[model samples]
Target: MEKKSIQNTLLMGFIEDIKLRYKTGNIVEKFIFINIGVFIASLLFKVIFGLYKTNGDFIFNWFALEHNFSTLITKPWSIISYGFLHAGFIHILFNMIALYYIGNLFIQYFTQKQLVQFYVLGTFFGGLLFMLSNSYFPLFEGTRPHLVGASAGISAIFIGLTTYMPNYQLQIRFIGFVKLWHLAAIWIGLDVIGLVGSNAGGHFSHLGGALFGFLYVNQAANTKLNIWDKLSGIFTSRKKPLHTVYKSSKKTAPKSKNTDLTQQQIDGILDKISKSGYDSLTKSEKEFLFKQGKK
Candidate 1:
């Protein structure tokens, strides 16, 4: 009975820790957790069904996007689901690394909500554009291609950052600092070339995302393109999670100016962690978070 009781206590503590992490984590961490969680679950399912020896394509089909019009009709969720699906470890690693750097740099100028909106929209449009092209193009007339991975979303983020700050220089390995627009050009060019070799749908989706990223940043600057705010407002009226985010700050005790933690500051740190990971935290920042936990 004591051992069982101890097990229960430990499990409860672990669950609370997980909840706290998710509650405090910024948009990037949440997305990574969801994607990695889904990937792990997919592998577990395959192993359980003894399909590990096979290609395991069937295991991921339920979530992977289908280029075929008829097959996609019943699995519409794949539009977004496919972004979270990855065929191999290397695929996910590169995509996540790109998202981390791009998203972090993006949040330096834009809000976290804007970053998420770009990612979501980029992935959706990428898939949509691919489907539209495939439906009309003669080159892919007889093939049914499956779209998967976060590359489109990552591509959108990468291009969006480049579009927003075209002259920003990045220090490339074995090369001196170069302008973002130059990098964007090279990346898109490679994808265009890859389309002719193989994985045409993936490459097409990437171009779609890149195009959207370029247009979205340019268009918003010219007008009141507050799409993320409008979508958030829709959820704000619901009897759900939105209300919790803005709950009374009165609950927390007041502090001196030296220790004061504003919402914006907290959000910035969270965003940094999301883009750069926990180890990026300084000693003082870690101490502040520890203090918050105690509270």
Candidate 2:
């Protein structure tokens, strides 16, 4: 009875620990868990189908992105669904590794919500590009390749971070320190070269994802967006700022104190950035800055 009780306690503890970790984990960790869970579920389904002497790939076929337009129309969710699936152990392993590092770095400078936007949108664009390649390119005439993997999403996070901080240095193993843009260049360069290779569709998807990341970060940082301003100015040519000449000292007194406090906090954060660097700021500090920037 004692031995059985001990075993049961240990098993419950292990299960509880996993549950706790998942609950406390950030969005990146949650994504990793989801991917691993999907991979294992796929394996289990494959084994079960094999035991019955039947094809197991039908399950994957339903979820994986089909290159054919007619087939894709039937399973539209596969564009995002395929990002959570993987072809093999090595595929998921590398993708999860890249996501973990790049995603963690990404959250430091951007919000978790923005990360999700980049990842999902990247996957969407990548899948579209993959389908387009199959339809237009003669090389894929005889092939019916299905897209599955988190590489497109990971590529977006990687390239997005690189774009946001091109000069950020990372100490690589045996490669010393390398600039973020340098690594991004190599990443895109390989994909570009792979266009003629067997995995040309995969490369196309990667480039599509990288392109989104680059364009998004560039547009965000483009302060002198004169064309956009000009277009908006044309539309709002007659609009003028509303002014309030009336004063309410009682209402304004408390607001001024709050505004001063917020400004002091912002000043403190700016000073910290100057002393250490943007990366040195804590998560809360970074979030505060991010919120302020939106305003």
Identify the leading candidate in terms of lDDT.
2
State how far residue 66 of model 2 sits from its true place (Å): 0.7
* Each prediction's whole-model lDDT (CA): 0.73, 0.78
Colliding residue pairs in candidate 1: none
- For model 1, the stretches where C-alpha displacement exceeds 4 angstroms are 1-19, 51-59, 221-225, 228-295
Give the clash count for model 2. 0
TM-score of each: 0.69, 0.76
- Candidate 2: tens digits of C-alpha lDDT, residues 87-187: 99998999999999999877765567667877887898899899999999899998999998888888888897686567777778998878888899999
lDDT (C-alpha) at residue 74 in model 1: 97
In candidate 1, position 157 carries an lDDT of: 82
The lDDT, on a scale of 0 to 1, for candidate 1 is 0.73
Per-residue alpha-carbon lDDT of candidate 1 for residues 1-295, written as tens digits (9 for 90 to 100): 9999999999999989988888898888778877787788887877766654665555487889888667778998888889998888888888878777777777655567777777887888799878987898788988888888988888888897776557667667999778778989999999999877678889999998888776666444222335565433422322221111112233446665744555456656665554454567899877765565455
Clashes of each: 0, 0
* Local distance difference test, candidate 2: 0.78
Q: List the residue pairs that clash in candidate 2.
A: none
